[model samples]
Target: MAQSVLHRDPRVDFFRGAAFIIILIAHIPSNWVAQWIPARFGFSDATEMFVFMSGFAAGIAFGGTYRTAGFWLGTARIYFRAWQVYVANLLLFFFVLVLMLAANAWLYADTDYVTQLALNYFLDDTGRALLGLFSMTYVPNFFDILPMYIVVLLMVPVFMALSRIHPLAGYAGCLVLYAANYVFIFELPAEVSPDRDFRAWFFNPFAWQLLFFTGFAMSMGYLKLPRFRWWLAALCLALIAVGVVYSRYGLWSWSDTLSDLRGQLVDLRCQNWRGDGADRCYFWTKSNLDVVRILHFLAIAYLVVWALKGRERVLTMGWAQPILQCGRQSLPVFMFSMILSRVYNVLMDQTERTTWEEIAFNVVAVANLIAIAYLLGWLKSNPWRPHKPARTPAPEAQGQAQGGARWGNAVPAPGSAE
Candidate 1:
């Protein structure tokens, strides 16, 4: 009898789709009606979730490749993908620059010629072009992730080599790097001006690699220990409760008893601490990992995974399928979405920034995103291409059977070897 190829994990698709929805919805300005579910609960910042999941997905997709093809191949693949992203980003950057120039010319025709030229040259093209590529000093404009993605690609080989030793060891290294980021790098001198160091190190690929490693480690059976799921659920619930309490009651507020407790728990001085300072605020937003943020993100991730169990029918529904399709080809979808979002932002005037209008805009954005994803999926599943079975070596095949037995093949494995 021939073996059948198992289904790929729907959890990844569902989560990625959910992340897109969160990203879109979170960007909309909150209205009276929108306050029912706090944006913070859904997703206050979409970048972290996207980056973390990207790492996780890469781990699952690329780990076996690293094992079989060795580190160089794995590194090459990641770098190639990174290069693709960089090229796409550059294209978008130039496109946006041209659009900005045109918009300024048409909209601000009444302005003085010199003023218009300066605005076009300094603000529209030159400043933004520099900001987009290096992402060094300017505010984190759209498409900044391209540079960060390039950095992460460079580190993939290092991560692949480390992962082979022990998944936990790789995770430990990521954690140590994250901790160093908070202690040594995040804090800036109170008197000194903030510049590239503030933005670059805060968004440092080295520090943020922890979230990606966490995802990768989990996919590789690092979290497969007995009772681990239950423990994670419990921990997640507890942290959520704490987060709720912290949100409700200003834990760091000047109330007498609470202030004292907050002082003891977190050094207020840490906020002002520069290079040599030990005052570390637990909630500081660095591109690096913060303990609170990590826990918060993990709790949400666990909840999503737990909710996804035995829910394939729900995920495969009419509307749901489109999101899943987008999730399937996430990289292309992400790049496309970024381009569309930038274009939308540029075309819309300040009048469209109204709360209700923003909400409607997001709804349309998500709908179009889903449509794009579905179209891509349809294109990929071309009826013209006949399906073929993959060949496997006899010894390697036997090893798989034994390994499956060891793992107790309750869950169906995906069709691809990786």
Candidate 2:
């Protein structure tokens, strides 16, 4: 019922589905295929896609509620989802903690992924860490994104309220907040433990909110995708090519034919993109949501839309259907991918793998993920799934129910009798 609330959009689902798999591959640092993922060629990666898609989804799903139900009720529904996300995140925190501990004992004891995830505080100061987790202040590595989403969703009512008076009012605020964050390089201060020390949130809400609201505005018709002019198409293709090369060749562990050329671009990007603790090879930082990253995502999106403009059948094809299904079941599939990535990371750390081997592993991982998502999608579509019954309308109405009598006088049809 949750996923069914919105009018299904296949394109968004396909992109979301693809983003989850790409994210899984990217998260496993030990995998050679990580380099071949989209981030290397483009400034943006799966995070941008996921965030933007979520925003668009919110606009459609919650926006429908605003128009059909009441504004406050729709906003409340969105917040209800935020709570669901938070609860899921809490489960994930404990789940990852247990997985890491078991993995440490069972496989790579020396790896200590618990520390990498920032969960070691729980090991040393359980009481303090517990407080932080409950308060949404103690976010571990992959868990950080949920807190950001929860905070942003809390603002949807305010954003929608402001938009009613003036279209740009809420969006302008999003820009100013983003600019302030970039200039200050700030994150929501997070308490990792009971200690006085504070840590900045991994995904800066101020910066990320801009993208979310942008997607919302676009979906709601406050903004629209720029017209696909010839120049625009060219621009998108060129940028997509740049991203492809980096992902295909930029050094992670192996070198491809284009590595030399990609190496030069990375060097130029480092000087052009100034920052502290910078990694020259990575054109943009995931947390910062750099201009390049933003543009790259836009470019990729344009290309997808442009290419698939009239190609409706492509998504429905047997091979692509799994991805579309996964995209539709994004919340479950994302959680699945995250856990799977961690397990793969442990395996990669313990043994050596070649680029081809890593690619093969991803191939297998994807097949399994698709199977799981397909099954979940099937479950979601079950005829017996719980849902609210349709409300009966008032007796007085202009049109009859294809019968001679009005609603108040109508008798039940022969086969329809209860």
Clashes of each: 2, 3
Q: What CA RMSD would you report for each candidate?
A: 6.1, 8.8
Q: lDDT of each structure? A: 0.55, 0.70
Residue range 192-219, candidate 1, lDDT tens digits:
1233233343356666677766766665
Clashing pairs in 2: 41-243, 41-247, 42-243
How much lDDT does candidate 2 score? 0.70
Candidate 2 residues 188-288, lDDT tens each? 66766545576677787878888888877766666766766999889888877766655535433355646666667566766734466545443246676
- Candidate 2: where are CA atoms >4 Å away? 1-7, 194-198, 241-284, 348-357, 383-418
Error of 1 at 90 (Å): 1.9
How do all models score by TM-score? Answer: 0.73, 0.79
